[model samples]
Target: MDTERLFDRSYERVLSHEVDGRAFFEGFYDAFLAASDEVAEKFHDTDMDRQQAMLMKSFYHLLSFYASNNADYYLDRVAISHNRHHINIRPALYDLWLDTLILTVRRFDPECCDETELAWRLVMTPGIVYMKFHYNRDSIVGS
Candidate 1:
């Protein structure tokens, strides 16, 4: 699946009226909550602390900043903050996150699985790397 096709499909899915932002968020939130538990169990750690939950919420907000008026500034600020504050970004957690996202998208639009999977892989691969790099850099610098 090429990028253009994938994006087109994503756009189509977005405009289909079958998939709403609220539904996406609700699905994502539920998936994240479930993944958090799996993460804790897999790592022998506890559920995410309040601080972690707050941080995750902020990340979601940052992702949505593109829909706002000051999108560029908001995006830049989000990137900077991710670079400065998210030090302990875990790959396993991210895998779980992506899984959740995929599941959510599939739940909403089963027909778009192939396109969604391709789009998500395209978007998330670079995103995860960028996030992890900044997060690790932040940890080292902050410490």
Candidate 2:
């Protein structure tokens, strides 16, 4: 998948104004909301909207950690925090995120959709669990 290269391209696209990173993030956020809505419906919970918003904030914090490009501390922290939060860590949420990313990439550069998907798949390797909050206490928590 050449994740490094793909990340480079993604950054380039963002920096060069070829694609609006903010807009892409918004789409990703919307996907999270939709996934959370589905999960809430399945569980017959009415707090899905609030849970989804909290997850979005947590994801933003993770993104900031990644942007720092420091030690792998953020990875471990994210992993542990995700395990603790348990609302943002669903396979269905990941599927929704991937779909949103694919659509965003296709909208900006149709030719890069395949590569973007490949890179995304590599970044989200098997055995990696997404974060979700089971307790309301962890809803506002972020890494």
Candidate 3:
């Protein structure tokens, strides 16, 4: 099956569950903070309301990228923004981020299933790859 179609179906299933976006992010942050003290410290001075909204938009952009491939623009920007010189989003953090997201999805998304989890993984792979590449590249340059 095509990736776009699969992602759309899974995304629709999640949305159809009628999960509140705000509440979902709150739960996600709770889980994420518990998973990593480093991640929590990074956000200590940040405004969560704005960050949550941006995270939702970024996820939607990631899902949409499978279809249009246009969302790759933001993906690149995200990679650049997370580089070592900026937010210093290391590869390990991406693993933690994905783990937290899946856990939160299982908690808040009533439609969560193996397929939904796979969709999230598949859809996020490209952006995560990009972020990891840039992080490594920046690390090399810094060294």
Candidate 4:
């Protein structure tokens, strides 16, 4: 699916709803903390309110990046910030992140469907891939 359609669905069905947005992030964080020890430990000291805000912004930025074509600047910074040497988000962890996000959407989104899930995946994949790619490169180059 194209990013424009995906963004439209994401905005109208998910992000634009205030209560669902809160529920979605709550579900995502709860599921993420329970998914693995590594994940749990990573966020043990983090400020979740701030983290959630950042996630929301980053998610929108991801969608906008695809929708606008020149808005990848934020995503590039996201990749750098999440690189292994910094936040240490590994490539493998992105799978868990995506899974939990989709599960959260299913649980919280009023209009959740296969297409909705696919749109989330399609919108999120590029950012995840970019993060993972830069994470790997930083690992190699920084070492």
Best by TM-score: 4
Clash totals for all candidate models = 0, 11, 0, 0
Show where candidate 1 strays beyond 4 Å.
Answer: 11-22, 38-87, 139-143
Can you write out model 3's per-residue Cα lDDT over 34-78, one digit (the tens) per residue? 898899898998898899889988887766665564545667677
Write down the worst ten-residue block by lDDT for model 3: 134-143
Off by over 4 Å in 4: 1-3, 15-22, 69-71, 139-143
lDDT of 2 by residue, 2-110 (tens): 7757855764563344445454444444444565666445446446556556645554555544445332444455555544355335545555655665565555543
Better of 1 and 4 by lDDT: 4
Report every candidate's CA lDDT. 0.54, 0.50, 0.73, 0.74
lDDT of 1 by residue, 1-143 (tens): 57546745664564353445554555565567777765444435434454455555654544444224233443344445655354344556667777877776676665666766777566555555444555545333233
Question: Highest lDDT: which candidate?
Answer: 4
Regarding lDDT, does 2 or 3 come out ahead? 3
RMSD of 4: 3.6
